[model samples]
Target: MNQAFRDLFGAKVAGAVASAKALGQVDHSGLKGALREVLVRSLLRPFLPPSIGVGHGIVISAYDDQSTEQDIVIFNRASLPCILIDEESGLFPLESTLFTIEVKSRLNATELEKTHEKAARLEKLRHTPGETTPEHVIPCLFAFETDLVQKTDLHRYQELIGTSDPSIREICVVGQGRWFWTPQGWHHTPPTDTYSEVAGLIDGISSVYERVQATRSRPLLLNYVD
Candidate 1:
């Protein structure tokens, strides 16, 4: 912790600390933006390699020309999701691994398409001349607050994941609800609600981020539905 921040948080910090500690234990339905961000950072920070870095609320350049930016892009997704670019340490550069995360209160096809375009465009830029190419395939993490993804809708999502590059991993976090992660060519049992299930989902999502730098696993699916 920075000295300046610590000084400011002295004495009265215990309350905030307590609240923060309780976040992971809280149900997803009760998750707020602050709490979710805290949880993700806490879980991801530990697994990161010292060489790689992490930031919060950072900008992700999607195209070589800087035409698009995202909430966060780990390395580069100009060509493949979760791929990291060594040229420049931002999204849209060559050889950079990118992880595109979508945290929505709810999701729709339109939103999904937009996210896909962002990832694809970044992938295209990775190889373009004068544009940095990310080395890693970007991964996708979708966290939501809902129960039960519609059967037809599940098929659409499965198709999207199938079309993505093999390096990319897709994980969905559904808060305090019930859902399933069924990609085409694979069958996953429907999720059921239970104690610690939501926390497990969050943990799995964090695991992906921690291991993203070294894995070629298919998009790992994490459904946290009631």
Candidate 2:
């Protein structure tokens, strides 16, 4: 069953990659980035549960603080409705967010630093009128390709994370490898095969969804006070 699942998922990822490469023919960076995001969203939709929603949006805290436009925001649609800002984006409450993803066409040192900065901002967002804030809204980074050498570049990646609280919990450089956070520290796992990378990505997301659902002790709306 697992092998069958991996085979099916790999085919979809391959198609997405081909579409992304085709999009690269366009000279406009903004257009290429937007289309790449669309490709990822479409890739994730069929795999995720219907109760979970996937969209491009900004995450907003109860205090009105907002996260920079996210490439993709995964949220609990079964319990909360995002404020639609447009056809392509919405304003998601921090409490409703399961996670946010930042997609890059190519992973480089500069891009990694930028993703870390965004994750830091996401970690700083606050929820109020409650004893505990939701702990499930993690930040993740994904890239179609990476310019950095995996072994030699590990230090540079670690330096970007520094000694701060980790907000970006999972990262996948498709076909290359992935990095995931644990209580001890960040760990890297090279793909066993091309398809395993996509499997790892999906597994990380599924784990986050389960953790989020497990931690939901009350109505999300109760976190906000007028």
Candidate 3:
């Protein structure tokens, strides 16, 4: 890394450690903003480089009808901005983008259920009437913070992802732990881990960063207006 990058990274680490400590007693709701700052400033920005760099990005804006849930959103310049809806909020808007991400601290039965539900809903919206189908191909990503186990809670999810359409892109599971991913129709299982280990996970599967460059769209409320 260059001197400037090293310096910036050092600063980011310091800020993140401090934020992590300060938010120890706070809830996710209270620390959303600070946590977002940490993810972009510390995790994503520092690791990815310009050549592999996706593109300009932005945080999803709150629509007048719905409450906020997500932390940050990245998109590709040529395509629409990617949307990430909060699992609890169920408030993802219809928009064209290369991909959509569902971030989580860990993966389990409940998490898979929620993800499946959200994916189903988004699929429905894509083919609905009057809804301007996103011009760009859409994909789904799950950023999990745990190692995956086979033939368990994540089995069905794994099956679904493996069988999903090409436009869906490959699913991502990020965490401190590691696991194997055998693409559906394939037999060999490849080892994988967090972005720290798998740098290409984002762009390899879906390049929403491209969409962010072309448009600066934000998530809007379709049904869950509150």
Candidate 4:
């Protein structure tokens, strides 16, 4: 808002980024991944309505197969046949999940490829009762920074991943930009500033919140298998 607050906010973001980079050098650990995931989950959960929750879980099939562990799961936990939990982790019904997200402190081609693979697995899982394709569940990838995908390289990456898995619908590289697909196709909004990126990131998710809620199907005529 004010120049003083802007400067303070910039300094804070820089500090957080520096901390994440330092954690990255420590090797494979939650220290590196959890920071981003927790921040994103906390920031995003409130933007969604009270009916939705943000947490970690997997989508499951009727036969008991499961999707890979999601970094964040936005779901309607109140819905029966949607969530089941045990000593380890929770499982979410594909129909009840509004979206799944993978968060990275930094994104690279390797991480990007792995993210796609996970998405493919989720795409293959069957939906709850009346639901069809996993296209209703938005796939998203978020990063604090990146060494992988970029504007100059986006075309090639898009071509490389073509028609393989359901593609990520929203990509927000904090302090960088937000990329998303629409009826008009792929659109990229380059970062204006850290504040704008933060705004855009939340706003991008907010749009999905509105969209999924708007188009959500009501399960009628339930014939309980149990």
Candidate 5:
């Protein structure tokens, strides 16, 4: 079962990467980026439980602060339906959001720093008062390629990790390796195979979903009322 799961997503990941590269020859970077995001959304939807909705959107707090457009916003559709701004985008309430992901065609130090900053801003968005939800939204960074040297770049990665919000859960660069956070500290898992990197990410998402399921109760949406 595990191998089948890995094989399925691994092929999807390869296909997405191939399609993105084919599109990269075009002059428009935005088109390529958007295609990558769409491909990633397709890969995730089939694997996630039906109750967990996925889309591209901006997450808004009750106070009206909003996250920048997220590449992938995973939320509890069964509990609270997000407002659809359009076919490809929507407005997800902070309390309804499980997590947000920023996808990149390439991962570099500058891009990683920017993602960290974005995650920090997301950490500031307060949920509806007294709502039964995760205290912080998990922020994840996913990239198809990376520019950092595996050995010499360790310090740079560590420095960013040292200062990032604790809610920033995972950074995955497919074909490279992944960095994940735990109560003990950050840990690195070198890529063991083409499929393992993405498989690790799916596993991480499942873990978060399971944890939320164990702790989450019916959210008190009434708390949003004045």
Candidate 6:
């Protein structure tokens, strides 16, 4: 809020971006997965309240449709039940998911298109209306580098991603230094802009899931383990 604090926060975000860049330079695939975990641990998990949780999992609707494994999934386990969970994967209840993120080691058309399709599929899964939770789940795509998209042509990418869907929000090419959102348009920045963008995400998350804890919904369950 204050100028002094703002400057401090900016420095921290800048540090995260710098760290990701260094990690991805050599082992783009392996280390990038590590970077995704880092982003979750630093940018997301800390911000998530106790009632809610963040994980890398797939969403499962009542119809048995399963989603592509997402890099980051913010769900309220305190309120809803998980359809399945094992050592390898977690199949979450669709309505329980509040937000989902797709992570990429680099930004390219192929990756972008795939992410778009995945988000669209998630959008089609209808939620079971019970308690009043956040009506729309925010879908986000974040990358550590860019190979196809140029900083100046963010609008071109936006057109490809489409604007009609409320479930999906925007593509944050943090390593490339730009982001495209249907509502706010494009944000062009330097390659090391990951932290600042993450800060924006925190603000958005706070506003969207602000009321979730007040209406925590729990389902009937039987827990047994060997």
Clashes of 1: 51
lDDT of 1: 0.42
Positional deviation of residue 214's Cα in model 5 after best superposition, in angstroms: 5.2
Check candidate 4 and list the clashing pairs: none
* Residues 1-226 of candidate 5: C-alpha lDDT, one tens digit per residue: 5777667767788998788667767778789778888877877787788888888888887677888778889888866567897865888877678878888887778977787778878888875545355556788888877777655234555676776435457777777777787778777777765557677777678768656544444445554444
Could you tell me the TM-score of candidate 6? 0.73
Please give the lDDT score at residue 150 for candidate 3: 52
TM-scores, each model vs. reference = 0.46, 0.88, 0.46, 0.77, 0.86, 0.73
lDDT comparison, 1 vs 3, better candidate: 1
lDDT of each: 0.42, 0.77, 0.39, 0.67, 0.74, 0.63
Worst lDDT 10-window in candidate 4:
217-226
Off by over 4 Å in 3: 1-26, 29-72, 77-96, 126-137, 147-154, 159-169, 175-197, 205-226
| RMSD values, in order shown | 12.6, 2.5, 8.5, 3.9, 2.7, 4.7
Cα displacement (angstroms), candidate 6, residue 55, comes to 0.6
Where's the lowest-lDDT run of ten residues in candidate 3?
Answer: 52-61
Question: What is the lDDT, from 0 to 100, of the residue 13 in candidate 3?
Answer: 41
What lDDT is reached at residue 85 by model 4? 71
In lDDT terms, how accurate is model 6? 0.63
lDDT digits (tens) for residues 28-125 of candidate 6: 57567756566645766666677677777888665556688887878876656664465324777766778788876566777777777888888776
| Cα distance off (Å), candidate 3, residue 77 | 4.7
Error of 4 at 125 (Å): 2.3
Q: Candidate 5 overall Cα lDDT vs. reference?
A: 0.74
lDDT tens digits, residue span 103-191, model 1: 44345667666666665554454232233322344545454433345543345556766755422245454433322232444223233
Q: Each candidate: how many clashes? A: 51, 0, 14, 0, 0, 1
Q: Give me the overall lDDT of model 4.
A: 0.67
Per lDDT, the best of the predicted structures is: 2
